[model samples]
Target: MTASRISNTTGWLSFAGVVAFVVGVFNVMDGLVALFRNDYYQVTSQDILVFNFTAWGWIWLILGLAQIAIGAGLLAEQSWARTAGVAMAVLVAIGQLAFLRAFPVWSVLVIAMCVLLVYALTAHPRTRAYPEA
Candidate 1:
C-alpha cells in the first residue's frame, strides 16, 4: 500500500476509534445507571413496556465492551479489527433501534456514527491504502 493510502486509512481508523470511545463511554454510563436504578428509564407506565434493569445493564455492558474493542482495533489498524469493527458497528446500530427509550438521543447519535463509520471504512481512499492489511 502507498504511504498516502495508509495515511488516509489511518486517519479514518483513528477517527472511528475516537468516535467509538465516546459512544462506549456513554454506554458504560447508561449501564451503571441501569445497575443502580431499574426505574431509571421509566418513560412508559405500561408494565409490559418496561425493560428489566439487569437486562439493560448487561446489554449496555456488552455493547460497551464491543465498542471499546472496535475502537482499539481501528486505532491499531489491525486487519481483523477492521472487519470486526464493521460488524460491531452494524450490530450497535441495530441494537439501538430497540433501546430508543433508554437512550433516545444517544441511540440516534450512534446510528449516525455507525453510518459514517461504515462509509469511512469502505471509502476508496482508505480501501486503496489499507487493502485489508
Candidate 2:
C-alpha cells in the first residue's frame, strides 16, 4: 500500500517510530553524560539504585543503539520492529525507574514516552502501512 489506503493505525505506528528514535538519541546522550561527564548528574554513582554510572552508561549506550536500530526498522515498516519496540520500551522504562533518583523529571518524562511508544506499537494489529519485502 499507499498512503491514502493507510488506516489511523499508520499514524500511531509512525508516531511510535519517531518517538522511539528520539528516545534512543536521548539514551545515548544520557549514557555519555553518565560516563564522561559524571558531574552533570545530580547524584553520585554510589547514590543510584542500580549499577555505577559507568556501568549504567554502558548499559544505556547499548540499549540506545538497539533502540535506534529498532526505531529505524519501525519507520521502514519492517515486520519485526513491533515486537522489538515493545521489548525495548519495557527495558527503557525499567531503566528510567532505576534512574529516577538521579534525575527525577527527565527520567519520568522518558518513562512516559516509552509507555506511549509501547501503546502505539501494540494497541492495534499490524496495518497496511508496513509490508515485508
Candidate 3:
C-alpha cells in the first residue's frame, strides 16, 4: 500500500475505535438501566421488538463490552481488531434495530456509526493489517 493509503487506513481505524468507545458507553448504560429499572424503557418486555428487557439487558451488556474491547484493540493495532470491528459493528447495527422503538433517534445514529465502522474496517484489507515489506 502507498503511504497515503496506510495513513488513511489508520485514520479510519482510529475513528472506528473512538466512536465505538463512545457508543459502547451508552450501550452499557442502557443495559444497566434495562436490567435494573425496566420501567425506564416505558415499555413492557412484550412491547419490545425482540427479547424481554432482562434478556435484552444482558445482550446489550455483553455486546457493549465486546465493542469496548474491539475499540481498544483497534487503537492498539491488534491484528484481530479489524475483523472483530466489522463483525461487532454489524451486530451493533442489528441490535440498534431492535432498540428502534425505544430510542428512535439514538438507534438510527448508532446504526449509521456502525455502517461507517464497517466501511472503515473493510475499505482496504492490506492497510488493516501489517503492510507488505
Best by lDDT: 2
Tell me the tens digit of each residue's lDDT in model 2 across 81-109: 99999999999999899999888998999
TM-score of structure candidate 2: 0.86
Q: How big is the positional error of residue 121 in model 1, measured in Å on the Cα after superposition?
A: 1.7
lDDT of 1: 0.72
TM-score of model 1 vs. true structure: 0.75
Question: Which prediction has more favorable lDDT, 1 or 3?
Answer: 3
lDDT of 3 by residue, 1-133 (tens): 6554334346777888887787787788878878899888766788779888898889889988988998898888887988988888888899989888876787898899888888887775453456668
RMSD for all candidates, in order, please: 5.8, 5.8, 6.0
Model 3 spans with C-alpha error above 4 angstroms: 1-9, 125-133
In model 1, which runs have C-alpha deviations exceeding 4 angstroms?
Answer: 1-8, 44-51, 126-133
Instruction: Extract clashing residue pairs from model 1.
Output: none
**21: Cα error in model 2, Å:** 0.1
Winner on TM-score between 2 and 3 is 2
TM-score, one value per model: 0.75, 0.86, 0.82
Cα lDDT for residue 101, candidate 1: 68
- lDDT per residue for candidate 1 within 3-112, as digits (tens), equals 55434355766787777777777777777887777676655323323466677778888888777877787777767767776787788778777677665887798789
